[model samples]
Target: MTNSTAKEEILGRIRNAQKIAFSGKDLASSAGVVTGTPGEHFAVPRDYERTSDMPREEVISLADERIADYKADVRRCSAEPAEINEAVKKAVADAGAKIVGIPSGLDKAWVSGLDEGKGEIRVDEGLGVRDLDALDAIVTSSAVTCAETGTIFLDGSPACGRRALTLVPDVHICVVPADSVVYGIPESISRLRDADPTVPITMISGPSATSDIELNRVEGVHGPRTLMVIIAG
Candidate 1:
Protein backbone atom coordinates (compact mmCIF):
# COMPACT_ATOMS: atom_id res chain seq x y z
CA MET A 1 0.00 0.00 0.00
CA THR A 2 2.97 2.28 0.45
CA ASN A 3 4.23 4.38 -2.45
CA SER A 4 7.46 2.42 -2.70
CA THR A 5 5.67 -0.90 -2.72
CA ALA A 6 3.24 0.29 -5.40
CA LYS A 7 6.07 1.60 -7.56
CA GLU A 8 7.91 -1.71 -7.33
CA GLU A 9 4.81 -3.65 -8.35
CA ILE A 10 4.30 -1.34 -11.38
CA LEU A 11 7.94 -1.71 -12.39
CA GLY A 12 7.63 -5.47 -12.01
CA ARG A 13 4.68 -5.47 -14.38
CA ILE A 14 6.64 -3.52 -16.99
CA ARG A 15 9.59 -5.85 -16.63
CA ASN A 16 7.33 -8.87 -17.11
CA ALA A 17 5.69 -7.32 -20.15
CA GLN A 18 9.04 -6.32 -21.62
CA LYS A 19 10.42 -9.83 -21.24
CA ILE A 20 8.06 -11.09 -23.95
CA ALA A 21 8.00 -7.99 -26.17
CA PHE A 22 10.38 -8.20 -29.15
CA SER A 23 10.55 -4.49 -29.98
CA GLY A 24 13.78 -3.97 -28.08
CA LYS A 25 14.50 -6.88 -25.79
CA ASP A 26 17.77 -5.38 -24.52
CA LEU A 27 16.22 -1.98 -23.67
CA ALA A 28 13.19 -3.65 -22.07
CA SER A 29 15.40 -5.34 -19.45
CA SER A 30 15.67 -2.19 -17.35
CA ALA A 31 12.31 -0.48 -16.72
CA GLY A 32 9.91 -2.55 -18.85
CA VAL A 33 9.97 -0.29 -21.86
CA VAL A 34 10.82 -1.17 -25.44
CA THR A 35 12.96 1.21 -27.45
CA GLY A 36 11.39 4.59 -28.04
CA THR A 37 10.78 4.47 -31.74
CA PRO A 38 9.52 7.59 -33.52
CA GLY A 39 6.25 6.05 -34.66
CA GLU A 40 6.14 2.65 -32.98
CA HIS A 41 3.40 1.89 -30.47
CA PHE A 42 2.40 -1.07 -28.35
CA ALA A 43 -1.20 -1.77 -27.42
CA VAL A 44 -1.62 -2.58 -23.76
CA PRO A 45 -4.61 -4.78 -23.00
CA ARG A 46 -7.15 -3.17 -20.70
CA ASP A 47 -10.22 -4.52 -18.94
CA TYR A 48 -11.86 -1.16 -18.49
CA GLU A 49 -14.96 -0.33 -20.46
CA ARG A 50 -14.31 1.97 -23.39
CA THR A 51 -18.02 2.46 -24.05
CA SER A 52 -21.08 2.72 -21.84
CA ASP A 53 -24.28 0.68 -21.86
CA MET A 54 -26.43 3.50 -20.56
CA PRO A 55 -28.42 5.42 -23.11
CA ARG A 56 -26.82 8.62 -24.36
CA GLU A 57 -29.68 10.78 -23.15
CA GLU A 58 -29.33 9.28 -19.71
CA VAL A 59 -25.67 10.15 -19.83
CA ILE A 60 -26.43 13.74 -20.65
CA SER A 61 -28.97 13.88 -17.88
CA LEU A 62 -26.48 12.56 -15.38
CA ALA A 63 -23.96 15.13 -16.49
CA ASP A 64 -26.61 17.80 -16.08
CA GLU A 65 -27.51 16.77 -12.56
CA ARG A 66 -23.90 16.40 -11.40
CA ILE A 67 -22.76 19.65 -12.92
CA ALA A 68 -25.69 21.47 -11.39
CA ASP A 69 -24.75 20.11 -7.98
CA TYR A 70 -21.58 22.18 -8.27
CA LYS A 71 -23.74 25.32 -8.19
CA ALA A 72 -23.30 25.92 -11.90
CA ASP A 73 -26.27 26.65 -14.14
CA VAL A 74 -27.16 23.86 -16.57
CA ARG A 75 -29.67 23.73 -19.41
CA ARG A 76 -30.54 21.81 -22.53
CA CYS A 77 -31.22 23.09 -26.02
CA SER A 78 -31.92 21.69 -29.42
CA ALA A 79 -28.76 20.77 -31.33
CA GLU A 80 -29.41 23.32 -34.03
CA PRO A 81 -26.75 25.98 -34.22
CA ALA A 82 -29.35 28.71 -34.00
CA GLU A 83 -30.85 27.18 -30.88
CA ILE A 84 -27.48 26.73 -29.21
CA ASN A 85 -26.65 30.33 -29.96
CA GLU A 86 -29.97 31.38 -28.53
CA ALA A 87 -29.33 29.46 -25.35
CA VAL A 88 -25.89 31.02 -25.08
CA LYS A 89 -27.42 34.44 -25.46
CA LYS A 90 -29.95 33.74 -22.74
CA ALA A 91 -27.29 32.60 -20.32
CA VAL A 92 -25.18 35.72 -20.87
CA ALA A 93 -28.23 37.92 -20.59
CA ASP A 94 -29.31 36.24 -17.37
CA ALA A 95 -25.93 37.05 -15.91
CA GLY A 96 -26.56 40.68 -16.89
CA ALA A 97 -23.12 40.80 -18.38
CA LYS A 98 -22.43 43.97 -20.33
CA ILE A 99 -19.15 42.94 -21.93
CA VAL A 100 -18.78 39.47 -23.43
CA GLY A 101 -15.64 37.69 -24.58
CA ILE A 102 -15.34 35.17 -27.40
CA PRO A 103 -12.36 33.44 -28.90
CA SER A 104 -11.46 34.44 -32.44
CA GLY A 105 -12.77 31.15 -33.80
CA LEU A 106 -16.06 31.08 -31.92
CA ASP A 107 -19.16 30.92 -34.09
CA LYS A 108 -20.34 34.42 -34.98
CA ALA A 109 -23.98 33.43 -34.52
CA TRP A 110 -23.26 32.56 -30.91
CA VAL A 111 -22.83 36.26 -30.13
CA SER A 112 -25.12 37.82 -32.67
CA GLY A 113 -27.83 38.30 -30.09
CA LEU A 114 -25.45 40.37 -27.99
CA ASP A 115 -24.79 42.67 -30.89
CA GLU A 116 -28.51 43.01 -31.56
CA GLY A 117 -28.90 44.03 -27.97
CA LYS A 118 -26.66 46.50 -26.13
CA GLY A 119 -24.04 43.99 -25.06
CA GLU A 120 -20.48 44.69 -26.17
CA ILE A 121 -18.38 41.88 -27.61
CA ARG A 122 -14.65 41.40 -27.10
CA VAL A 123 -12.95 38.92 -29.38
CA ASP A 124 -9.93 37.04 -28.02
CA GLU A 125 -7.65 38.20 -30.77
CA GLY A 126 -4.46 37.61 -28.79
CA LEU A 127 -5.94 39.02 -25.61
CA GLY A 128 -3.73 38.85 -22.56
CA VAL A 129 -4.67 38.01 -19.00
CA ARG A 130 -5.51 41.58 -18.18
CA ASP A 131 -7.73 41.96 -21.21
CA LEU A 132 -9.50 38.68 -20.60
CA ASP A 133 -10.00 39.55 -16.94
CA ALA A 134 -11.61 42.81 -17.93
CA LEU A 135 -14.40 41.00 -19.74
CA ASP A 136 -17.61 40.31 -17.83
CA ALA A 137 -18.20 36.89 -19.35
CA ILE A 138 -16.91 34.44 -21.95
CA VAL A 139 -18.59 32.07 -24.39
CA THR A 140 -16.94 28.83 -25.47
CA SER A 141 -17.56 25.31 -26.80
CA SER A 142 -16.54 22.15 -25.01
CA ALA A 143 -14.71 19.07 -26.33
CA VAL A 144 -15.93 16.15 -24.23
CA THR A 145 -17.78 15.69 -20.97
CA CYS A 146 -17.83 12.84 -18.42
CA ALA A 147 -21.34 12.26 -17.15
CA GLU A 148 -20.48 10.27 -14.07
CA THR A 149 -17.95 12.84 -12.85
CA GLY A 150 -19.89 15.83 -14.10
CA THR A 151 -16.59 16.89 -15.61
CA ILE A 152 -16.03 18.75 -18.86
CA PHE A 153 -12.93 19.06 -21.01
CA LEU A 154 -11.72 21.92 -23.13
CA ASP A 155 -8.84 21.33 -25.47
CA GLY A 156 -7.49 24.27 -27.43
CA SER A 157 -9.63 23.55 -30.45
CA PRO A 158 -11.34 26.15 -32.58
CA ALA A 159 -14.55 26.16 -30.56
CA CYS A 160 -12.74 25.58 -27.31
CA GLY A 161 -10.20 28.36 -27.35
CA ARG A 162 -6.89 28.58 -25.54
CA ARG A 163 -6.93 27.67 -21.87
CA ALA A 164 -6.57 31.29 -20.81
CA LEU A 165 -9.79 32.34 -22.50
CA THR A 166 -11.78 30.25 -20.05
CA LEU A 167 -9.56 30.84 -17.04
CA VAL A 168 -9.41 34.63 -16.79
CA PRO A 169 -13.00 35.66 -17.32
CA ASP A 170 -15.44 36.06 -14.45
CA VAL A 171 -18.19 34.02 -16.11
CA HIS A 172 -18.02 31.21 -18.68
CA ILE A 173 -20.85 30.06 -20.96
CA CYS A 174 -19.92 26.77 -22.60
CA VAL A 175 -21.92 24.91 -25.22
CA VAL A 176 -21.76 21.12 -25.14
CA PRO A 177 -22.83 18.90 -28.00
CA ALA A 178 -24.89 16.00 -26.71
CA ASP A 179 -22.97 13.46 -28.77
CA SER A 180 -19.76 14.43 -27.01
CA VAL A 181 -21.12 13.53 -23.59
CA VAL A 182 -19.92 10.16 -22.37
CA TYR A 183 -20.85 8.11 -19.32
CA GLY A 184 -17.53 7.72 -17.53
CA ILE A 185 -13.91 8.81 -17.46
CA PRO A 186 -12.69 5.78 -19.39
CA GLU A 187 -15.00 6.46 -22.30
CA SER A 188 -14.11 10.13 -22.16
CA ILE A 189 -10.37 9.43 -22.45
CA SER A 190 -10.91 7.05 -25.36
CA ARG A 191 -12.61 9.81 -27.36
CA LEU A 192 -9.85 12.38 -26.86
CA ARG A 193 -6.75 11.05 -28.63
CA ASP A 194 -6.75 12.76 -32.05
CA ALA A 195 -5.31 16.05 -30.90
CA ASP A 196 -1.87 17.51 -30.49
CA PRO A 197 -0.19 16.80 -27.16
CA THR A 198 1.05 20.36 -26.92
CA VAL A 199 -2.47 21.67 -26.54
CA PRO A 200 -3.48 22.08 -22.91
CA ILE A 201 -6.41 19.98 -21.67
CA THR A 202 -8.56 21.51 -18.95
CA MET A 203 -10.82 19.28 -16.87
CA ILE A 204 -13.47 21.16 -14.94
CA SER A 205 -15.88 19.54 -12.53
CA GLY A 206 -17.15 22.84 -11.33
CA PRO A 207 -16.27 26.47 -11.09
CA SER A 208 -12.84 27.35 -9.73
CA ALA A 209 -13.28 27.11 -5.99
CA THR A 210 -11.39 26.04 -2.93
CA SER A 211 -12.20 25.30 0.68
CA ASP A 212 -8.54 24.94 1.58
CA ILE A 213 -8.33 28.37 3.12
CA GLU A 214 -9.69 27.97 6.67
CA LEU A 215 -12.16 25.40 5.27
CA ASN A 216 -14.28 28.22 3.94
CA ARG A 217 -15.09 27.80 0.28
CA VAL A 218 -14.09 30.63 -2.01
CA GLU A 219 -14.89 30.82 -5.70
CA GLY A 220 -13.06 32.33 -8.68
CA VAL A 221 -9.62 32.25 -7.12
CA HIS A 222 -8.08 30.18 -9.93
CA GLY A 223 -10.61 30.45 -12.75
CA PRO A 224 -14.08 31.63 -13.61
CA ARG A 225 -16.45 32.00 -10.68
CA THR A 226 -19.61 31.26 -12.64
CA LEU A 227 -20.11 28.37 -15.05
CA MET A 228 -23.13 28.14 -17.35
CA VAL A 229 -23.43 25.03 -19.46
CA ILE A 230 -25.74 24.68 -22.44
CA ILE A 231 -26.15 21.10 -23.59
CA ALA A 232 -27.23 21.06 -27.20
CA GLY A 233 -28.71 17.89 -28.54
Candidate 2:
Protein backbone atom coordinates (compact mmCIF):
# COMPACT_ATOMS: atom_id res chain seq x y z
CA MET A 1 0.00 0.00 0.00
CA THR A 2 1.02 3.62 -0.48
CA ASN A 3 2.36 5.52 2.55
CA SER A 4 -0.84 7.53 3.16
CA THR A 5 -3.06 4.47 2.85
CA ALA A 6 -0.80 2.41 5.17
CA LYS A 7 -0.84 5.25 7.75
CA GLU A 8 -4.64 5.49 7.60
CA GLU A 9 -5.05 1.72 8.11
CA ILE A 10 -2.80 1.81 11.21
CA LEU A 11 -4.59 4.88 12.60
CA GLY A 12 -8.02 3.24 12.15
CA ARG A 13 -7.00 0.19 14.21
CA ILE A 14 -5.37 2.38 16.91
CA ARG A 15 -8.45 4.61 17.24
CA ASN A 16 -10.69 1.50 17.60
CA ALA A 17 -8.54 0.33 20.58
CA GLN A 18 -8.24 3.79 22.25
CA LYS A 19 -10.23 4.74 25.35
CA ILE A 20 -10.80 8.03 27.18
CA ALA A 21 -11.33 7.14 30.86
CA PHE A 22 -12.88 10.33 32.28
CA SER A 23 -15.85 12.60 31.59
CA GLY A 24 -15.53 16.28 32.50
CA LYS A 25 -18.10 16.02 35.34
CA ASP A 26 -16.53 12.84 36.75
CA LEU A 27 -13.04 14.36 36.84
CA ALA A 28 -14.19 17.65 38.38
CA SER A 29 -16.32 15.97 41.08
CA SER A 30 -13.58 13.48 41.98
CA ALA A 31 -11.19 16.39 42.47
CA GLY A 32 -13.75 18.11 44.80
CA VAL A 33 -14.01 21.01 42.41
CA VAL A 34 -17.11 22.99 41.43
CA THR A 35 -17.03 25.44 38.56
CA GLY A 36 -18.66 26.32 35.26
CA THR A 37 -16.52 23.65 33.64
CA PRO A 38 -13.73 21.16 34.47
CA GLY A 39 -11.01 23.32 32.97
CA GLU A 40 -12.23 26.39 34.88
CA HIS A 41 -11.90 24.54 38.20
CA PHE A 42 -8.23 23.62 37.76
CA ALA A 43 -6.88 26.49 39.86
CA VAL A 44 -9.75 26.35 42.42
CA PRO A 45 -8.93 22.91 43.80
CA ARG A 46 -5.18 23.59 43.99
CA ASP A 47 -5.74 26.75 46.06
CA TYR A 48 -7.74 24.77 48.64
CA GLU A 49 -4.92 22.40 49.71
CA ARG A 50 -3.17 22.84 53.08
CA THR A 51 -0.55 25.53 53.25
CA SER A 52 3.11 24.55 53.52
CA ASP A 53 4.38 23.72 57.00
CA MET A 54 7.93 24.97 56.47
CA PRO A 55 8.83 26.99 59.53
CA ARG A 56 11.03 30.07 59.12
CA GLU A 57 13.39 29.21 61.97
CA GLU A 58 13.64 25.57 60.89
CA VAL A 59 14.28 26.60 57.31
CA ILE A 60 17.07 28.91 58.38
CA SER A 61 18.72 26.16 60.41
CA LEU A 62 18.38 23.65 57.60
CA ALA A 63 19.97 26.05 55.12
CA ASP A 64 22.89 26.69 57.44
CA GLU A 65 23.53 23.00 58.03
CA ARG A 66 23.37 22.10 54.34
CA ILE A 67 25.67 24.91 53.25
CA ALA A 68 28.12 23.97 55.95
CA ASP A 69 27.98 20.32 54.97
CA TYR A 70 28.48 21.07 51.27
CA LYS A 71 31.44 23.28 52.10
CA ALA A 72 32.89 20.65 54.40
CA ASP A 73 32.35 17.86 51.89
CA VAL A 74 34.05 19.81 49.13
CA ARG A 75 36.97 20.51 51.40
CA ARG A 76 37.26 16.85 52.38
CA CYS A 77 37.22 15.74 48.74
CA SER A 78 40.06 18.21 47.95
CA ALA A 79 37.57 19.70 45.52
CA GLU A 80 37.39 23.40 46.41
CA PRO A 81 39.98 26.11 46.22
CA ALA A 82 40.79 28.48 49.07
CA GLU A 83 39.38 31.70 47.62
CA ILE A 84 36.59 32.64 45.19
CA ASN A 85 39.10 33.84 42.61
CA GLU A 86 41.20 30.77 43.19
CA ALA A 87 38.16 28.50 42.86
CA VAL A 88 37.16 30.11 39.59
CA LYS A 89 40.67 29.94 38.26
CA LYS A 90 41.11 26.31 39.25
CA ALA A 91 37.78 25.21 37.78
CA VAL A 92 38.59 26.89 34.46
CA ALA A 93 42.11 25.49 34.39
CA ASP A 94 40.94 22.02 35.36
CA ALA A 95 38.64 21.97 32.35
CA GLY A 96 41.01 23.87 29.99
CA ALA A 97 38.07 26.24 29.73
CA LYS A 98 36.75 29.66 28.78
CA ILE A 99 34.41 31.93 30.72
CA VAL A 100 30.72 32.78 30.25
CA GLY A 101 29.66 35.19 32.98
CA ILE A 102 26.04 36.20 33.49
CA PRO A 103 25.46 39.95 33.37
CA SER A 104 25.02 41.43 36.83
CA GLY A 105 27.42 44.33 36.39
CA LEU A 106 30.21 41.99 37.51
CA ASP A 107 33.20 44.04 38.56
CA LYS A 108 35.81 44.30 35.82
CA ALA A 109 38.39 43.19 38.35
CA TRP A 110 36.39 40.06 39.22
CA VAL A 111 35.71 39.12 35.59
CA SER A 112 39.32 39.78 34.57
CA GLY A 113 40.52 37.69 37.50
CA LEU A 114 38.66 34.61 36.19
CA ASP A 115 40.66 34.77 32.96
CA GLU A 116 43.78 34.29 35.11
CA GLY A 117 45.49 36.84 32.86
CA LYS A 118 44.74 34.70 29.73
CA GLY A 119 42.52 37.53 28.39
CA GLU A 120 40.25 35.30 26.30
CA ILE A 121 36.79 35.66 27.82
CA ARG A 122 33.30 36.62 26.63
CA VAL A 123 30.92 38.86 28.59
CA ASP A 124 27.35 37.87 27.76
CA GLU A 125 25.61 41.08 28.86
CA GLY A 126 23.08 41.00 26.04
CA LEU A 127 22.07 37.69 27.64
CA GLY A 128 21.19 36.17 24.29
CA VAL A 129 20.98 32.43 23.73
CA ARG A 130 24.55 31.11 23.68
CA ASP A 131 26.02 28.53 21.36
CA LEU A 132 26.87 25.36 23.28
CA ASP A 133 29.63 24.03 21.00
CA ALA A 134 31.54 27.29 21.22
CA LEU A 135 31.41 27.31 24.99
CA ASP A 136 33.53 25.21 27.34
CA ALA A 137 31.96 26.40 30.61
CA ILE A 138 29.42 28.84 32.02
CA VAL A 139 29.53 30.50 35.43
CA THR A 140 27.01 32.62 37.31
CA SER A 141 25.49 33.34 40.72
CA SER A 142 22.45 31.44 41.94
CA ALA A 143 19.43 33.25 43.46
CA VAL A 144 19.34 30.75 46.31
CA THR A 145 20.20 27.15 47.05
CA CYS A 146 18.65 24.32 49.08
CA ALA A 147 21.20 22.88 51.47
CA GLU A 148 19.12 19.84 52.37
CA THR A 149 19.30 18.58 48.79
CA GLY A 150 22.44 20.38 47.61
CA THR A 151 20.32 21.89 44.84
CA ILE A 152 21.10 25.26 43.27
CA PHE A 153 18.13 27.47 42.37
CA LEU A 154 18.61 29.65 39.29
CA ASP A 155 15.95 32.26 38.73
CA GLY A 156 16.43 33.53 35.18
CA SER A 157 16.72 37.18 35.96
CA PRO A 158 19.39 39.74 35.07
CA ALA A 159 21.90 38.08 37.40
CA CYS A 160 21.40 34.42 36.49
CA GLY A 161 20.35 34.76 32.82
CA ARG A 162 18.69 31.81 31.00
CA ARG A 163 18.62 28.14 32.01
CA ALA A 164 19.97 27.09 28.60
CA LEU A 165 23.48 28.32 29.37
CA THR A 166 23.57 26.14 32.46
CA LEU A 167 22.20 23.06 30.67
CA VAL A 168 24.00 23.28 27.33
CA PRO A 169 27.59 23.52 28.51
CA ASP A 170 29.66 20.55 29.64
CA VAL A 171 30.53 22.32 32.89
CA HIS A 172 28.64 24.84 35.05
CA ILE A 173 30.13 26.77 37.95
CA CYS A 174 27.51 28.22 40.29
CA VAL A 175 28.33 30.88 42.86
CA VAL A 176 25.99 31.13 45.80
CA PRO A 177 26.11 33.32 48.87
CA ALA A 178 25.82 31.79 52.32
CA ASP A 179 22.96 34.08 53.30
CA SER A 180 20.94 33.11 50.22
CA VAL A 181 21.12 29.38 50.90
CA VAL A 182 18.00 27.72 52.32
CA TYR A 183 17.63 24.41 54.20
CA GLY A 184 15.26 22.24 52.16
CA ILE A 185 12.79 21.96 49.26
CA PRO A 186 9.83 22.82 51.48
CA GLU A 187 11.48 26.05 52.56
CA SER A 188 12.55 26.88 49.05
CA ILE A 189 9.04 26.46 47.64
CA SER A 190 7.52 28.55 50.42
CA ARG A 191 10.02 31.34 49.87
CA LEU A 192 9.21 31.42 46.15
CA ARG A 193 5.44 31.71 46.63
CA ASP A 194 5.44 35.45 45.99
CA ALA A 195 8.01 35.48 43.23
CA ASP A 196 7.35 36.92 39.77
CA PRO A 197 5.47 34.17 37.95
CA THR A 198 6.84 35.12 34.52
CA VAL A 199 10.44 34.07 34.97
CA PRO A 200 11.67 30.49 34.60
CA ILE A 201 13.63 28.88 37.43
CA THR A 202 15.82 25.80 37.63
CA MET A 203 16.78 23.65 40.60
CA ILE A 204 19.94 21.63 40.18
CA SER A 205 21.66 19.14 42.48
CA GLY A 206 25.13 17.86 41.69
CA PRO A 207 26.20 16.84 38.22
CA SER A 208 23.51 15.42 35.94
CA ALA A 209 23.52 11.73 36.74
CA THR A 210 21.33 8.67 36.17
CA SER A 211 21.39 4.95 36.92
CA ASP A 212 20.87 1.92 34.70
CA ILE A 213 19.02 -1.38 35.18
CA GLU A 214 22.12 -2.82 36.86
CA LEU A 215 22.18 0.23 39.18
CA ASN A 216 25.33 1.47 37.51
CA ARG A 217 25.36 5.23 38.00
CA VAL A 218 26.45 7.50 35.17
CA GLU A 219 27.01 11.23 35.31
CA GLY A 220 25.91 13.97 32.85
CA VAL A 221 22.99 12.02 31.48
CA HIS A 222 20.80 15.07 30.73
CA GLY A 223 22.84 18.09 31.81
CA PRO A 224 26.43 19.16 32.44
CA ARG A 225 28.97 16.44 33.05
CA THR A 226 30.44 18.35 35.97
CA LEU A 227 28.92 20.74 38.53
CA MET A 228 31.29 22.96 40.47
CA VAL A 229 29.93 25.26 43.17
CA ILE A 230 31.68 28.28 44.73
CA ILE A 231 30.28 29.69 47.92
CA ALA A 232 31.16 33.35 48.01
CA GLY A 233 32.33 34.55 51.38
Give per-residue CA lDDT, model 1, range 3-56, as digits (tens).
999999999999887776756546454777655666788666688677778987
Instruction: Give the distance in Å from residue 148's predicted Cα in candidate 2 to where it truly belongs.
Output: 1.8
lDDT of model 1, residue 225:
93
Task: Give lDDT tens digits, candidate 2, residues 50-81.
Answer: 33356745654554455444332131112223
Among residues 3 or more apart in sequence or in different chains, the pairs in candidate 1 whose N, CA or C atoms overlap within 3 Å are: none
lDDT of 1 at 12: 99
The window of 10 residues in a row where model 2 has the poorest summed lDDT is 72-81
Clashing pairs in 2: 62-183, 63-182, 63-183
Error at 67, model 1, angstroms: 0.9
Candidate number achieving the greatest lDDT relative to the actual structure: 1
| Residue 126 shift from truth in candidate 2, angstroms | 5.6
- Weakest 10 consecutive residues of candidate 1 by summed lDDT: 20-29
Cα lDDT for residue 227, model 2?
Answer: 72
Point out where model 1 deviates above 4 Å. 1-43
